[model samples]
Target: MSILVYINSNGNKIAKNSFEAVTYAKKLGDVTVVTNGKADNTILADLGKYGASKVLVDRSFDGTDEQQITRMVATAAEKVGAETVVFSDDLVGKAVAPRLSVKMNAGLISSATGVPQGDGTVPVNVFSGKAFAFVKANTSKKIISLLPNSIPVEEVGGSASIEEFNGNAGDTRVRVKGINRPEGDIPLPEAELVVSAGRGLKGPENWGMIEDLAKALGAATACSRPVADADWRPHHEHVGQTGVAIRPNLYIAIGISGAIQHLAGVNGSKTIVVINTDKEAPFFKAADYGVVGDAFEVVPKLVEAVKKFKASN
Candidate 1:
């Protein structure tokens, strides 16, 4: 009765959220990882740092159809005698877990935010992370999807032992469509600190200062939903109820008036700092710290302060 984690093959390295899943899995059983690409041992080495003891390498781990991959993992799960299969609550994980649970006739718990006890009960939050509840599995096999950013990763040890899966990858129906990414070195959804703007930025051409602040702090850049709707920023950069929900350690909202929908998405951040000229803006109530001043005037000075702070440190 061990916990088995399915690590995603994102680019050459592993997915950041998968690391959190590994951390959660290690607590329940022997940590095992599955990789689908021809990544070298170095890629697996990082996983080892976070306590993954073994990595199962599969040539067919590609973005094949759900039917084939579910079978492949299910076969491996049965062979390994994994009583419980854990997956990160990601796009791919959300898609595959239910199917895998149904195919294996296992109990399914999606969006689990905490570790499960030896018992069948799993804890989850509801009402937009406002409340907690325990979910119990009905079957012998329990499959759980863990939410991202719920658990922090700690490097206990183990680079990972690489093994091969005896499955063919050609049977999947889904094919790779296309991949798109941000312009900078960091992906915002995964960043610890995020420097974001809203429609208050006026135009996209004025984004240089925003980028400068983000670059200085090694943070990701983001914008409000309206900015994305206005085409001032990419839809990918939009953060709100209809957009991405971020849980960064620090989030700076420059010129954003802070709507209820926007607050719903960003309320998960550890610390929120809002900068706007309107003193009575709704965002101020939700902000951990706020500055009631124009962004154009305040942003440059704030950027300088951050630079000085970093330099002094």
Candidate 2:
């Protein structure tokens, strides 16, 4: 079987999600990587290390208009005679996979956690990570969007040759301007660990300890829905059913009562740690590790412990 995997780059570097997707696709069969925009020599070498047999760079993508880009990728998959195509279940994958499915008349599965089974079925999370649903496509060709961090990134012995493909970009309706990123802030979707707080900290003035602990752990800082709604934190930092959904390796909740909506967003986390003064807080029910204590007393010691560990190591 031949598989075509889409690799999304962050400037000249490959995103972790795309790497995970590539690593997952390598297990299936022969893998071909298709990248949009410009890819540096360093990134191409990294793809070869991850087992990409051939890398097709599409410079005509122009990084705008998902519709036009989807057409380009679909055409490339056809040219390569790919039986299956894979993508990282991120913003770009979410936008392009369904379109490709329509264009190729193939089966499309999003947020898939595993590779195809013997019956061509894939497992995906249902009901906000509450359960698993098996999905299958009746079509001969299939498209899959793998969830980030669901599969470990393993290196296989292989090398890839780079090839350039100038695709039909079509009429560009959007214009590129500039990107604005805040300094020292990690994108929650890509963070391996996240430390989040709620109103239990009292007010926004008391968020220093949370930030300090997150900084010490090299984790992203998140907030509950109420915290963002009340303007204590930005909306981007909010995690819940109504906010951002995250699937980090470790999730630490400070002073936040576990509402079902909040749990829905982070239930995909590999491990959950909840710290709250209220012993009756609902969050403890879902926590892998629960500590009944005040944030003021607990966070400082946790930060100190992290600092001490780092210093010793």
Candidate 3:
């Protein structure tokens, strides 16, 4: 089977989830990656390390126009005669996958957690990570949006042939405006380690501890919806059902009472550590490790420990 994998890059670097998608697609068939915007040849070729056989660079589009992207992907898939199309279950994937599915008359499997089984059924995350379900696509063409961090990435050691794709990007309706991004060391969705907090820290003045811990651990910083709503943190940092969803390797919650809406976004984390004074906080049930203590006392010690460990190592 021939597979077409759609990836997005931040001008200079490719997103980690895209690499995971490429790796996942490789397991099913020969992988061809399509990306837009300007990037270095070396950066585009790096997809091969994750099993991409070829990289198609389309410079016609610079920004994410979902409609245009759908058209480009459909055109590329048709050109390559791809039977399966793979995407990372990110914002771009969520927007474009359905459009491409309808355009190609293909079956879509969103939130695929694993590769296809022997019986052609795919495992998927259902009910907000509370359960798993298997889905099958009876159509000749299939589209899959893989959940981030569900698949491990490996380097197979080869460079993919880079080629220019002249696919139609459709009409441009969206105008380009200046982008205002939150200041941070790492993007939250792509971070492997994330340190988040809620109102339990008292006020925004106490946020230093959270930043200190995140910096020491080389982690991204996040906040609960209430924190963001109260203007203690940027809306971009909010992680919850009404905010950005993440599936980091390790998630550290400080002073945040775990609400169900908040858990919906972070429940997919591989390891969760909750620190709250109240032992009865709902987040503890979801945490792999729970510490009942005051953030004022516990956070400093944790920061010191992380710093000392880093120094020793």
Candidate 4:
């Protein structure tokens, strides 16, 4: 079987999730990596360390125009003779995978987590990451979109041989006029720890405490849906059913009432901490640790304690 994985390079390096996708691609057969635009050949070569045998480049896919990418991927897949195509189920993959699947008549498994079982069966979460489903594509072509943080990236030592697969990519109707990046070193969803606030923070101005705590703990900062929608926080920092979902190692909620939609997103965290003045807030029910207190006063103390702990160590 010839398997190919799409590589979303982060600068000269491949995105972390792409590494996980490459890890999965390595299992099926000779793995080939497809990248867009010009990237450091050294970065493409490093993919060999993750089990890729070939690398294909298509410069046109670098633009955010979805059609350009769809055409490029479609053309690249055919050129590589790939039976299976792997992608990280992040923003870019979500935009491109379905179109590629339709163009190739390939079976698609979006948000797939585990490795394929016998007979091309892979597992995916259903009902908004609430249920399980097993899927098997009977067709010869298969498309697998892997969830970030779903699998560990495997490392091997050896440079992958670079190869060029040529095609005249099509034009995209939609174009990216510009790009807006989020501020901060820690990516919230991918952070190991997260500190969030809700209506109880009173308003966005109070976010300073949450930000301080997050910085101290090397954690990400987020807000409840209402707070974000209210423009108290950036939409990117919102976490809930209708917003971003995360499964950080530790989730700290300050002043959140923990409605079902809100909890659904954070329940996957390994540990949950709730801080609210109201003991009866629904968030307490799901919290591993609860502190019934004012966030303003309690947050400062918590920050001091975490800072002290760091200093002590």
Highest-lDDT candidate: 3
Better of 2 and 4 by TM-score: 2
> Which ten-residue region of model 3 has the weakest summed lDDT?
176-185
lDDT per residue (tens digit) for residues 1-313 in model 3: 8999999887998888999999999999999998888988898998899999898888988878999999999989998999999999999999999999999999999999899999999999988888899999999999999999898887888999999988799688999778887799798888999999999989999999999999999999999999999999999999989998999999999999999999999999999999999999999999999999999999999999999998999
- lDDT for model 1, please: 0.81
- The candidate scoring highest on TM-score is 3
TM-score for every candidate vs. truth? 0.91, 0.95, 0.98, 0.89
lDDT of 3: 0.93
Per-residue CA lDDT of candidate 1, range 170-237, in tens? Answer: 56555677866667677666778999998788999999999889988889999998899899988888
Q: On lDDT, who's better, 1 or 2?
A: 2
The C-alpha stretches of model 2 lying farther than 4 A from their native spots are: 176-178, 182-185
User: With candidate 4 superimposed using the best TM-score fit, by how many Å does residue 39's alpha carbon deviate from the native?
Assistant: 2.1
Report backbone clashes per prediction.
3, 0, 0, 0
Candidate 2 collision pairs: none
Ranking by TM-score: 3, 2, 1, 4
Give the C-alpha miss distance for residue 171 in model 1, angstroms.
1.7
Ranking of all candidate structures by their lDDT, best first? 3, 2, 4, 1
Better of 1 and 2 by TM-score: 2
Cα error, candidate 3, residue 147 (Å): 1.1
Better of 2 and 3 by lDDT: 3
